[model samples]
Target: MNYEKGAKEILENIGGKENIAGMTHCATRLRFNLRDTSKADTAAIEAVDGVVNVINKAGQYQILIGTNVPKLYNQMENLVGPKEAGSKDSANNSGSSQGIIGTIFSAISSIFAPLLPALAGSGILRGLLLLFVQLGWLSETNGTYQILSAASMTVFYFLPVLLAITSARRFGADMFLSALIGAALLHPDYIALMGDIGNGATTSFLGIPAVLMNYNSTVVPIILSILIFSYLYKWLDRVIPETLKLVVLPLISIAVMVPVTIIVIGPLGVYGGEIIASAVNWLIARSSILAGIVVGGGWSVLVSLGIHWAVNPIMINNIATSGIDYIVPFTFACNFATIGTALGVFFKAQDRDIKNFSMTGIVTIALSAIIEPTVFGLLVKNKKLFLSQIIGGAVGGAYLGLTNVYTNAFVFGSVTTFPAFVGDTSANFINAMIGLLISLIVGAMIAYFVTKKEERLVKN
Candidate 1:
């Protein structure tokens, strides 16, 4: 990908490292908050070999780079510096000016992007373990299976501790204290206490009636707890004297925050998260086909606008709490449909420019399931290709819904992650493969015909 060359071009066009206040990336774009946006040369950036397209949004100069963004971001960071509060233009980098959606996506990316690589590894491992067990190569009860499952599940089961650290960093809270709060939530005695309460036994913390909610594998609760911690940490630092700040603050903060979290913040967050999960499940239940069609067909629009990740925590929650999720199949369809559209365009486009663009996009999507280059670079520029995407996505999505396909884990885009779709039986894996094949085949055919017809009309 010409890592060093691309990094140099980006820095030069975006007004050098000093112009960058801070930077972050989502699934497909490098979002940079620059001290001065007018200084960037958008034309030069678009001309960069590996660059896709650029946009000014979210209080940042966004450069779309598909799935290879992390590598580019690392190279850029080495060239410039780490993106954080310590940067040169940090004073003007706050998101107050970035509307609601921008702020939301920024926060979502900060927390989830850091965790995706780990989550993908664990999900793939879990899926592999299931595949081996189902094939009778290993018994479900085998010590090996138990150990592997523990390793796989621990990422989720103890996710709060992970989120605490990430959330603490995102919210500018104390990472160690946030982790301490997470540990307290998962402590063995605490689980026992929750079990007792579940069995009709009573419990209290500091004479306050404590809620008996399990925080393991949960998302929102720790976020809320850490939010409260951040505020408390700041407040304590202000009021507490210097001599006793370290010793007295940590002791007092834990004592007060832990009980308040268990009694109030944790339950509230749980309920809110549950409501969101329940609502999505309800929509799927109301009409799986309808939900599938919208999510599958229109998800690209969401991705284009960079808001698709708002659903990340929901997907994770559904799998963690419900044992399976229907949402991913729709996402899977969207990804494959994109690849199909790109392939079809590559085959049909007569112009060398369009042909080369589509071919490159196809290879990228095939390997990493990244659609930005194909999308912004080609699909959006070609109406016929996008039409093919809609048709293909709808077909794949409906197939998933009608056949009851689901996944217990989430992997990023790519057909290679198909193993994660294994269900209690082989039917799920089989159904998903067939549906994906049909979606791609149908989309490509449509795109090919559309291009042929357009060419004939032009000739006539």
Candidate 2:
């Protein structure tokens, strides 16, 4: 597909590599924090071969490039050279233009973006392992089972350590130093201390009572720690003499920050995450149907706008705290609805390019559950198809809510991982499949009829 040519054309239209402030790529898009977004020629960039669409959202200019984004991203990165560490360009641009909410969302998304693949792979593996156990294909006591289970569980068990690295990069802190803080929170000594505290033991750091909690699998505490740590490290780096900075600064920063984190920041972050998760629980408990409709129907829209990341932490918190989450279950419908939209288009569209595009979207969604190619490449361009997706998702979501379906693991909605939705009762599994089918069928029918009506109108 002449990827090198496509990369060159893309850079040329976005004011060349010099216009870029910082850049990153995700599963389906190239995200650029530009010095001046106005310098970008969106139309010209979209016109480039291999590009599907362009979006300006969450303080970044995004180019949708389907599953081949990494290849394109590599080529583009080579052209732009290496990005500097602690680049505050995004913060500056986000503050002035994106406002507080957008800035926060942008930060959260970028911080977690790099971890998605690891998380998704581990999550799917966990789901599959559980399914195997339940199906009696693998015994829980088997050595192979234990090894596979450990492989699946490692990332989640040491989640704080991973978040520490990503958060440090986001906040312009020392990644290794930040990792030390995360490791400290998950230290075996501290974990044992937590057990002692649970069974009546007291501990203190410097006269103040120390409150320790298990930080493994937690989302917020390490990130908050790193954010504060970054500020403290920068301050220490400035004051310490250059000659002494290497040893004294890290020592002092660790001494001060570790205590402060254990005594204060960690608890605050944990409680904060709990509060957010509890609030979502309250809303869903009050009315699961309404919650389902909103999340299911609106999830694709959120994905389109690139702010879906705001809800991810809440889902993770729900899973960590409660062993189950309902938020991700609804988005399954949104994904299948996208597949339905493609099927409708494939059958009705006479244009060979349109048919091929729809065919590709269907295959992409079926295989990886990635719908951006379908969403940005096709759905957004056709209001009728978009409506089909919304209606289908809403219908399917309502059904799931009515039955109170949920997934035990943090799974990316996909055809391969349907077993993740299995519950204690057979009805739970049955209902999930029913809801998925409802979404698919409804979306396909609506899209088909709507396209037919549009064609008739054109003929008339």
Candidate 3:
């Protein structure tokens, strides 16, 4: 269906948007926190033209919208206003800690979902630029490189602003004004002041010992700050008179929050980020191969269940903080193995339609790192190929870990973006290529042999 019609149907079926306390979109779902669940029409929502399915979990009414979710979310938001708010506690909160954990992940998914396209595009550009520079056709010190680098890093440098806008929408705050708070966090004056603090300058805000922390490209601090800002803004809106509200609200919120973040939240956010980074690092430290094996082996299971997003924060945080990541090599191996399995499927298929679809899956995996086509089209229909691919993933993961291979940037796992995994030295790239080759050979051979055997048994 058209975006508008789909959006209208969605709104009407979900109690006309008035029942929505807050709304957020993830990679494939539109999550709604409703003031009253009884108002929703679950059956009609399921039958909406663009909807894939309906889910209710983590105290959310989740409508599956596939990749078009962001588009639908925007259309819905334009129809309604900035969405409404619940009380001090959001309606999504649950009593059990496990449910709360799911809620947090749901929020993270929604917050990051809108940002991925921009990030993916920038990452690709950065990868291409890095490739040209490595080939000696471009120079890092050249103006072209400088311009592209700025383009690539813009979202990262002003990440707070993007997070502020998305999180504000999720938490039911004024998105534009919260973005101003984000802008202020990265203001030149504040950045310059942070430089002084880095150089051992002591600073204070209204007699409070200021604990300044760099906010650029960070995740935790910005989200925390926005959460605080949302409540403060909502509370002020209630107390202040409507006539004076616009003039007084933004002024008071900023005046209070900027200092609050700088002196209190920012430092704590740094601590929180460090803890997150450290935990991921610690896992690999215990034993890279064991870690790789566990991640590689279970990665497919996680992806099949849509739980792989749980690992995204750690990998992104590692790249953001340390400029490198060890956790994602397993992803690389898994992608290569899946591609190999798809190639085997292509050769083994007797049906013309199956053969044509398998070829498409092969191309999809080789270029885009998306293997759902292969997984659903071939592997789920053929058990042997799936198991072989998983085994190949484990083998590749262990070998990469043994070689100490690492990726220096955030990249979707695929051969098309191999340059993204290249490090300061060529060795990293060589090792990764080795891992790729081994994964392909092992997985493809197993799939071929197993398929042949199964076909023979069927004939008999």
Candidate 4:
């Protein structure tokens, strides 16, 4: 296919990969963080034979080339080298014009992207534990079950600590100080305090009314706290003498910030999260079916533009407040459609390189649930496959809506949410399972037949 030539040409048309500072792919596009958007020849790139579409969003230039994008991505990566050519620029531009909302989303996505593999691994382990327990292979009281469940639960149960460290690093705050903040939030004392408050007891920290809220399995509070910590840490470093700064700054920051977080920041963050969560819940309750279709069909598009992070807090809040969320279940169905369609391409591809690329993309999508490789590498170019995924996602989404499935966990997509179904015995769980299975089967079947017909036509 002369992938190198194609990649080089594409890069050149977009003013060379050097003009690109950072790049990520989502279901149907190569989202490029460019040095300057004006340098990109969007029209020229779109004129390329396999290119599908072009979009500019969230300060990124996106080139859509359909499902076989991962192959081209690899070739582009090879041409451009491993590290992004312009990360410094990306970091600089990150804090500039996008506003506070943009900065927050960018920070969260960048911080979490590296840790997603571990997160998924832990989720899969948790799902397996549930499966074992459900099948009677392990009892909840058994030591083996206890150990395995701990392996999975530890990550989610102590998630604040993890986020504290990652968010600290992302915002350039003191890691230890951030960890201390998270630890305080998860402390037994704090939990007890929250319980007391819930039971109609008043609590105060140094005469200030203490607002007790559980931070476990929560997302927004920790991130927000760390962002505040970052600015505080920076200020402390500036005022304190350099030699004493290292030792004393962290100590002072922790002492001040931890109390502030507990007594003030955490409560405000939780309250804000509640408001956003309530709005989303109102929307879902009012029109779950429409929400399902819109979220399911367009989530990849949202992710492509980095707008998906806005929904993260809402999903976590739904789990925290309502015990389940419909958006996440539909998200799973959407990813399943992408993976299934990719699997079809892997099986049906005649070109050796294309076949190998599709196979690898299937594995990546399964483990990481990153759909860009599949969307750009295979489906977007293959009209039948693209239609198949859309149809499958819409069908699954409507089914989820009709059944009113709710997911307790936060991971997005089908395979990861499988365990969420185990905790529920209602028709919602069954409907979710059916939605996933139907999306996989229908998307794959349609892709197979369609791809075969297309291949035959090309040969003729």
Candidate 5:
């Protein structure tokens, strides 16, 4: 693919660099906050070579370009220049019109999208380390194991720091100040206070008792704090005299926000995360098979709608709160089901373009666990293939749910990361493998037969 040429065409169709208010990219999509989305031509953009799909959703114009998105994004970024920090784009200014749900979805996607690669890598490492231990190749007490464990766990343990950096970018807060707040929440003294709380040791600020909770690996606290800090910093920037702005702004913002976070936002955010996790847990507990069937069968639909990012927090919170999560475990089935369906297309489809595209999707999905190329490029155009995906995913999901398989770490659902499915019992991992095979074999079989039947009908 001529990324540079394709990038130029994309910019031209998206109303040129001048139309862009903000620009970012995730694993497989370029997200643009356009000053006037109406000025952008979606059809023309999609017609560009290497471009798979163009979606105007969640207040951003997203271009799906598969695993090569980062390379193209670099080209586009070079052309557009660095996106202005805290640009007041329509996406930022028109939150009210987008409604609460859209606003939240956009915020979550923006804040977490960039972090997925790091999270996925660390998760894979965690799984690998566990495999080494289980196979007796690594001893838990060995210094080598300790260092490797730290490498795998560092991102998760200091998640707030990472989240603060990303959240600051999203909310237009000073990254350092936001990160300072996250660090302050995890200060060793504050963590020690968790132990002291039982000994009648309580801390207070301005006569208000501060609730000291472990903010390490928490999702919502830093986000809520940074959101409030953004508003405060903007107001401060407006009021502070131009000469004293540099040091005074950060000083005052940190001083006020950190204490406020400890006193109010931290506890509220913790409670909020708990509530969301509890709701998911309650659903899973009610009827695991039903929950699995819905999530697994409908997972691709959520991704197609671009709202699947919303589930990330719940999965993270489940691990932080319960030491394990079932969400991603079930999605494993969907991932394999997608791979199987794509393979079916490669084998059965008559069109040269569709067959080649399906082969590309299979390799991409198997390695990176990204399904956009498959879901958007193939399944959306073929009802029979999609039905195969739904039936295969549901059957696998039901089995996984019935068996209650879960994982301790958050990993991408892919062939390489299958070790991440290690659960409480040996049988748990076995059951997960069975689910993957069931989804793959069933999806391929159904797709193959259905496409053959379609061919017969065409002949008639």
Candidate 6:
């Protein structure tokens, strides 16, 4: 692939690897945190043969390179060294290091990435169980059904444990310790205690009463707890003697942080999460149409720069507290737009390789809910196609908002989310289907008109 030369040219065009503060790659894009956004040569980089698109958002520079992105990412990382981009940015330099909106989206992508495979596997199993029950093959109360349901439900029910482990790794903390902390939150004793307190129960440490909260399938609390643990672990390691450091530090951390987490951090995090959830719900309750438009239209932009992780917690929190979330319907629109746009590119493209890639990407994204492959492969190469998807997404989101569609489960954007609709036989399901259809139609229509055949563009 002449990746060395390509990597050098790419970094040079983007003002060199030195300009990058941190960098990471999703399935199809190289996301860079650059020190000087102005130094980025977007047009020049786009001219590179393998380059698909370049975008700047949330202080990160995103390079779309499609499914073969990992190879390019390896080259870029080799040149730059792996590190968090923009870590050196002074608070003033970045202008508020991912504002409230940025943080929300960042949280969603970060939380979901490592756990997506497990989520997909479990969701598929759940879907199969639902199918069996619907077909009279097994009763919901049957032992076989119960076992199968448990296999699928366990992932979600004990999600905090999984999040804790991944979040700890992301933040560079002790994995086992993080799981222990997550376990503490889900302890039966704690749940029993909270239940006994009912709506009025609160536990106190010293003189401060711990805010009563549950942590199952919760997001913010675990991530936040891991962040604290990361810092604490680092500090403890520095102070403790080298010979005994590993053993002593872990012991102390578990002894102190676990209690502190249970009594202080965990409760506080849960309370804060609830507040945010409440605010979002209030806004949705008041004007779902506006929320839908903003979320659906802007969701791709969020995903592109790895900011979508922040919102997953909010949606999960909504599901835990409110039994449903309208936000997920908007995400469905976003995925459909990507799929439709990719399909459009597949049909319009004259290059055999490009056409094949686009077709494969579209099918994979639609089936697996992984849009990066399509986004970077097809839409990024065709700016008009990208815009088409966004426009289509906005339209679908608006439609869904008007219908007040909601999803009760935390499934990714694909067929897996169908079960979420099954239990809720409201207009929400119909609205979701309509939203998906609208996104597909609008995106395909736009792409059909905007995309140029490879032969036509190259000839011209």
348-409 in candidate 2: lDDT tens per residue? Answer: 76777777877888887877888887888777877888999998998899888888888877
Q: Count the backbone clashes (under 3 Å) in each candidate.
A: 0, 0, 0, 17, 0, 18
- Cα lDDT tens digits for candidate 6, 112-168: 666766765775576567656766788988999999888877877787889888776
TM-score of each: 0.89, 0.94, 0.83, 0.76, 0.94, 0.79
Give the alpha carbon lDDT tens digit for every residue of 1-460 in model 4: 4567778878898888667666655444566767677888877887676675576766556676655666787888898764331244555665553446655655655556545555556655766676787778989899999998778667666767888887776677777888988988888877887564552344787888766677886667888898888889878888999899867997898888887887778778877877888887788789887877777667766655657866765775575456566778888878887777766766776766666766776676666566765665566666777788877776677678767887655675745447765554546567888987777777777777776622421110
Candidate 2 yields a Cα-based lDDT of 0.81
Q: What tens-digit string does per-residue lDDT give for candidate 3 at 1-460?
A: 6888988988897888667767766666677777677788888887778775566655567776655677898898888765532223453433332256556765676677678777667766776787788889899899999999899878678888998888787666788888987888788887787664462344787777775667777888878988888789888999999999979998998898888887778778878888978987887887888777777656765655445666876777676777678988888888888877766656775656656766776776787776654654466556787898888888888888878788766677777778777677788888899887777777887877776522421100
- Give the Å error, residue 324, model 1: 0.7
Worst 10 residues of 3 by lDDT: 451-460
Tell me the tens digit of each residue's lDDT in model 5 across 1-460. 7999999999999999878877777778887777778889888888899888887777667898888888998899789886732355634544533446766776788788888888778777887788788888999999999998999888888889899999888878788888998999878877787784532346888898876677888899899999888889889989999999988998899899988998889889988988888988999999999988998888888887787889988897777667688888778888888888877766886776667777887887788899987887777777888989988888889888998888777777888788787654678789999988888888888888777522321100
After superposition, candidate 1 runs with Cα above 4 Å error: 1-5, 15-21, 34-39, 57-60, 78-80, 85-95, 196-202, 237-245, 350-357, 452-460
Between prediction 1 and prediction 5, which has the larger TM-score?
5
Candidates arranged by lDDT, highest first: 5, 2, 1, 3, 6, 4
Flag regions of model 3 displaced more than 4 Å. 1-24, 28-98, 195-201, 376-386, 449-460
* CA displacement after TM-score superposition, residue 33 of candidate 6 (Å): 4.0
How would you encode candidate 1's per-residue C-alpha lDDT over 1-460 as one tens digit per residue?
7988999998998999888876777677898767778899998998898787887765557888877788998899899877753122442455444555665666676777778878878888888888998888889889999999999888898889999888777666778988988989889987898664552245787687766788888999998888678778878888999999889989987888788877888889888999999999999998998887888788777777676778888998987777688988888888888878767766776776667766777777766777777767766666787879878888888888878788879776576677789778999999888777767887788888777522321110
Give the range of the ten consecutive residues with the poorest summed lDDT in model 1. 451-460
Q: Give the Å shift of residue 29 in candidate 2.
A: 1.0
State the C-alpha lDDT per candidate: 0.79, 0.81, 0.73, 0.69, 0.81, 0.72
List of clashing residue pairs for candidate 5: none
Among all windows of 10 consecutive residues in model 6, the one with the lowest summed lDDT is: 85-94
* Ranking of predictions according to TM-score: 2, 5, 1, 3, 6, 4
For candidate 4, the 10 contiguous residues with the lowest summed lDDT are 451-460
Who is ahead in lDDT, 2 or 6? 2
